[model samples]
Target: MTTSSGSSSHVTDARGPLHTGPGDQHIYYGDIRASASSDRSGRDPRQVAVEELRALRRRFVDPVGSDRARELLEDKRAVMLTAGRGHGARTAAKVFLCQLPQGSRRFRELVDQAEEGDSAGRALDREQVERGAALLLDLSTVSSRRYETFMAELPWFLKVVRECDAWLAVVLPALWRAGFEHVFRGLVVRLERPDPAAVLQAHLRDVGIHVRRAEVAVPELEHELTTATMAQTADLSEDIRAARENAPPGSGFAAWLKTALAARAPGAQDVEAHLSGLDSGAQRALLLTTALLHGARTDTVHEAAARLARAAELPEVATPLLHHRTLTARLAEIKAAAHRGRVRFTVAGYDAGVRRWFWDNYPQLRGPLADWLRTAPGFTALERADRLELVTRFAHERLRTGPPDGLAALAERWSGPSASPEELTMAARALGEGVVHARYGSHFRQQLYRWAQDTALPGHRAHVVIGVCSEVLSRRFPDQAMIRLRHVSRHREQGVRVTAREALARITDSDDRLYRSLLKRLAPGEEPRGLRDLGIFLHVADPARMAGDATVGALLADHWTAALAHLPPRRWEQPLRAWLERAHTRPVARRPALRALATACARQRAAFGAVYAAACSWAAGDPARRRTVNALWEAAGSVPRPQPSRTAAAAR
Candidate 1:
């Protein structure tokens, strides 16, 4: 019953010959024979069987039948016995049989053939006979359990299997398919049966096969292990090798046994149960081991760390395993990998234990700290103090070595509300460097503004940054420096306010154009506080000579009018004296500024009359001021008086 297609196309039954397909072939395992030319044209029957098995698995629960199907079953049986444990295959076979049409004649014929082929040197090939035995054990029905009928079918298959050393390998898969643990227990029961050899001898005698020797001697069985003699008789080595080779990822007897005994942790419950059973010391050791190998990044490892932390009552034990040289040294390679950014974990305050462990070793693990600061999750979970500490440390480290390329951005990030004094200083220094040295200074200008608005930054620290900025800007960015100093002057700290004001004064005094520029930016009624003092220094403090300068006089009149109006009457004498003396002694060409000063002073006649009179006397000798003096006198006299109140009229 073979064909060139490599699948069995024909089978003989009471109905005579049946053709399965165009090119099917049948293989006889017990007797090796050369096939006809036509039968040899296609693939090997074993390979075809493997392909069909894979196809069946892919189909998942498809019905299977036909002579070719029977042939493929034989192929599975052969491979399962020799190269694989029958567990996976037997399970698959049961499912496949369950899916077959119930009353299909072809399937029934295959079942009958499987039964008849069970005897030694029977009508079927040895492989076919083995498949028949597996089929019978896996035959499930509503009336009887699959394994309950194993004894009834045993007599038939026992004839062929008794001669084979691999009988256990062949039969175990069938039993395993029925129930994983029950099969192993059943083997132990059979082995421990009193005079098991005699029981088999009786069965053989009933079949008219005289057994001269007790070749089937049962060995004592222990609950833990099958006896060595029984193992040898069953050829356990072949079964073990076969199981390993052919077991699917999560199937097979070993996998089933592991599942049954909870050997491997398949989930959290299993893991928890196992740890629960350990002694306190063992549990601690397990936690330490987990911490050593798995950081808190993964949920499982984090859970393990949490469990250990809960069990630890003392601070010493609560310390993470990474702090222990005994554990950490062994994981140096993993640490190296983590440092290279190949692995990611956050030691932030998301978990107290993780935080303590990470920070303790942060110095050694700083290689990835910058990247983590930039990208790791849970950074915000760190407490404000810890964040400040880490950010400051990183900023200083960056500044010292000259930040790695493109890493200056991290320094800017630290200049926030939570920024420590050290961190704010670093941020300011970075900004100063960018302004003075980096080509991308403007790019960070907005960042500086943002930092400026961080009101939570300590006053002293903010003052320091303001100082750095003012100094840098005075030289390199005088215009911006003026604005920044003006803003900082309004701060709540008197020292900071004074520092900014002084900085503005120095900047204004050093550069006249900058002084004028600063004045121009001040709105008429709203003079900047930083420059309020500057107006006095320039216009009123040394006013005697300053009045003689047109620029100084105009600046005073335009923006510092209120400052001018508020200047003490006593302080006005010096500028007026200097103006009059200059008019009297110097040439007329310079007198316009003095005259302008006189007009501005006359406008403030209520406050400046006495200083104006002193100036009039000093200017009396100057030819240009003869009219100027009379004009000043008249201007002073024409000052309007305040209106009386209605209450005053009632009193009258």
Candidate 2:
């Protein structure tokens, strides 16, 4: 295609921006214009983002290395240089941003160990930590909100935000150092007396921090130093802490509340005294929160409730704890914390304390925790809503889990409000529907096992069967229900594997007594009847010979119909495989049965019923058994006897 321009045509220069081809789906903007120049190579867009991020860090960085911010710049620069692609760069940035807020924690730890002369490093480190933390907060908000239009390019945003976080760290600490609170102090002075005692007392007076003992007033004229003078001194922190504790709530108001409290709120100790003085429910709520803050972990209903009761008297607050204003506030905060998706109790001791303290503060959170745990994987299977309530209460109230303890802190949380067994059954049914529910049931069953201390074979078998069945149903037919589960009868304390004598008795009962005199000599456990046990009675009745019976073939054919009528054929295979693997003696019955079932299913592909499977699985495993069955069929002229010999039908 060629075009000739007339005299009125537009003029163009040699260096004119040429129109490149329109971009495909990757352009992100949906714009027709391409980002690449006419002579550009098809390099990755993420690379461009990384380069831009590096450039941004350089823009904020000061070269003198004197501005502690250089450290931040260096960190961000390293990420960009290492992150060559978009995802790499973006992920790095996201992680850094997430980790930045934690930097303050690092700073605080350093400050604790930091010595006298390393002041510069402490100050610098402090700046870095706080900035990192702030940056992380911002990045989390932005990334969560997805701020960029060409958002497919994550590396660019990551690099930019990471650098921003580093810079913020450097800047924030400096802002604090720049008399952020002293500025407030100056304003307080202008507004009122700037009296440390008065200001501190005012903030704490109505709040829970009361004067356990008032300090002897130091004469103002005698000391010569005001709140400002003491604040400026290097030992001000130590003095402020002592004063906050001993000189009344407001004694060290200017220094303590403004500086120290800004970094770490002083509540646990202050409110704790009042907590002990409150009624049981209130005290329990508080202690639970405190425990959580200290990194305590507990889930047993009995244990948690007991701990709460032991730590704080619940009986005292039974009447008014529900209505207390402080309790209400504390519950609201803990709920908010849980919603934030960071309910981990991992701090050395603070998390545990916080957890127990929080529960003590609010008795109502018991409902929410129960509801939450009900939806949690293993916990959901709890048969009783009240059981869930008990469990959550226990976790919040009395548990102490962390590096400090390896034991499950047991304590009863619900001597007052336990649910009925019917409620538990309903809960169990709902919870048992999912894999998560199965896990919860397993946990609950284990608890039962522990209590019974009866690891007897029969008891163990019952538990194992239930667990295995639940797992298979959950994993294989995720959406299926356990309909028609009329009863769950558990076997008593029998040994693990079935004994020969018992097997004989079981088989005798399982035999089709239609020709009672015919099989009078049959083993007790090896019943050949298809209808008496619904296929399960004969399941293990015969230890030596039941499975070898020729009737098993016809029996399977008959029972397959009922099995299909209950569970759809699509899901039958898993249960069948499970039964074979667990109940059958073959080395790898489950996998082989599964393979055989799959092969049998190849033809039907979509259609399924009981007869089809029975035929396919009629005689599997031993080739000799298959030959004998064929010979037997021929010998009887295709007439199957009521029951065949066990040895004759061995595995082919």
Candidate 3:
């Protein structure tokens, strides 16, 4: 063997046996295979694999690397093929191939070595084919058993092979022969499906060479283990069923009621007799169901109570029915009073304390209240808004002190026209308290959005509707609030716009931080892009007030056109057209407000052009009116537009 330093080959004892020690300098597969057991004895398995790896590295890499050693060994192929002229050379090639990286390097070397023979006069024989098969088995055992070492060295091995393209065209026909197919198939399974050498997998299928997949016995073994243990489980289940069938008869209330009621006893006369035999818990369950069933009337309740008293020989039969006898009686009384269309109770008297008392014991009172509220003629006749306000106030007050019981149902019924500001306020209050019910959330958000856009509502009240939306609904319903804030930012009223801008500021807090950083870098006279998109420009508080500060006034004036045009014409008309129509007739004291409106309207001349045209039409044939229309147009022109930045240009 040639040494890495280009020294002559070492003299051997005609080789007695190869030693795996550092002083050893010969390769012997037979000696190494036998020494494996002794080398591994009383040693860590990982340490043994490491020691064996170092020996193989010394034999392979030290001999001018595996590629050169493989070429030198293949040079003796003609002699090795003839009788035993180069047996040692063939053995060296097999050992060297086993030490190389699995598929890419080893398989390519085998095919390349065979192809060289075709170019020359040599042809592959059974000896070379057997050597290749044995080398694959040995390598597979190392990879399948000592996986840690193979994986640790794989990255460097692949890096070496990938730097060359010569291996791409080679194919190993020896692997497709009988008895050698499994080695190729096993490598294909172990590699990724898109591996560079995946053509080998197609070749195997084309040649009809099938390697049976390994049987996966893990799930089957688990089933057998479970089946063995489940025999006792099956027997236990049957025994439980038999016990349920053969058990003694029950003397519980349901059993006794079944027997007593089966007789029918001419109109359930013995229901009280049956009740007397049950425990107190059973008695409460029975009477509560009976009183709430809608079939039981006032007389039926009294008769049932009287019969229980006679049968039990007590002064009275006590249950929640007897405890809240007044509320129960009031339930029956409400029907008659509700029919007459008047149930006298002052609204002031129904305070939080009264609401709390009813809800504190809601379980006992909900059924009767629900029955009266649903069935009472007066409840049905009450104005929709009034009824909604009543129940909503009750629900809000009750939820203020406890979890949402049945009050959400009452609040949900107040949809459509009944969803007033007061109703929305109550719903907002419930939401802020973390009372998350599906009914009060999205439906109420839709109602709040409609109310905010309702032009018929006075400006102050409409402002209040949105104030509740921003203050309470922003956290849970942020997207809805953002849409509303975008539309309302240009409201005709300065106070309402200021409120909306403040709400927009609260909702976009994180984005505003980023905008603030970019705002600092803006040139003194240049407008920032996406100013309206970031919603920062919406903070135009009382344009008259902002006009006093030159910096803020300049900022608004610069982006005024872009901001106003961001929303379309249809949106501005709802809140703005009415104000603009009277812009010409307003007193001189209101000129600043009118001028501010003109700044926004003048931005989108195409959309608001009609409004300006209508003003000019109304101004026709009157010099004074025409002069006012001309002044409005002049005011619109006077509002500033951003100049091209001289400072930015100079710096650039």
User: Model-by-model lDDT, in order?
Assistant: 0.37, 0.29, 0.34
Deviation from truth (RMSD, Å), model 3: 34.8
For candidate 3, give the lDDT of residue 261. Answer: 26
TM accuracy, model 1: 0.29
Listed in order, each prediction's TM-score against the native is: 0.29, 0.23, 0.29
Better of 2 and 3 by TM-score: 3
**Clashing pairs in model 1?**
3-25, 5-23, 7-24, 7-25, 8-25, 83-242, 86-173, 543-575, 544-574, 544-575
* Candidate 1, 1-652: lDDT as tens digits: 1111111122221111111112112112001111110122333322233243443334232122223333433332221211032113333343343233320111111121222223342222333232112232322211234234443444455456444321222223223343333223323211111222333333334434344443332232122122233222223323333444545785654443233222111334433444455544433433342333332223333333333443433243555766644423322322211333222322211122333334343344444445444432232233323333333344434443443333456554544556554445444444555543322444444444544544444554455446555555444344555655655555555555555555565545433334444554443222444234433233322222232244544554432233346555454455455544444443532345444444555555565656556656766677766655665556445534322111100000
lDDT of 3 by residue, 317-436 (tens): 356854654534443332211223333222112223233443454455545544343322132233433333344454554455544544444433322244544343333333333222
Of 1 and 3, the candidate ranking higher by TM-score: 1
Of 1 and 2, which scores higher on lDDT? 1
Model 3 misplaced stretches (Cα beyond 4 Å): 1-358, 361-393, 413-560, 563-582, 587-615, 633-640, 643-652
Runs of candidate 2 with Cα error greater than 4 angstroms are 1-327, 330-637, 640-652
Evaluated against the true structure, the overall lDDT of model 2 is: 0.29
For candidate 1, what is the lDDT?
0.37
Worst 10 residues of 3 by lDDT: 1-10
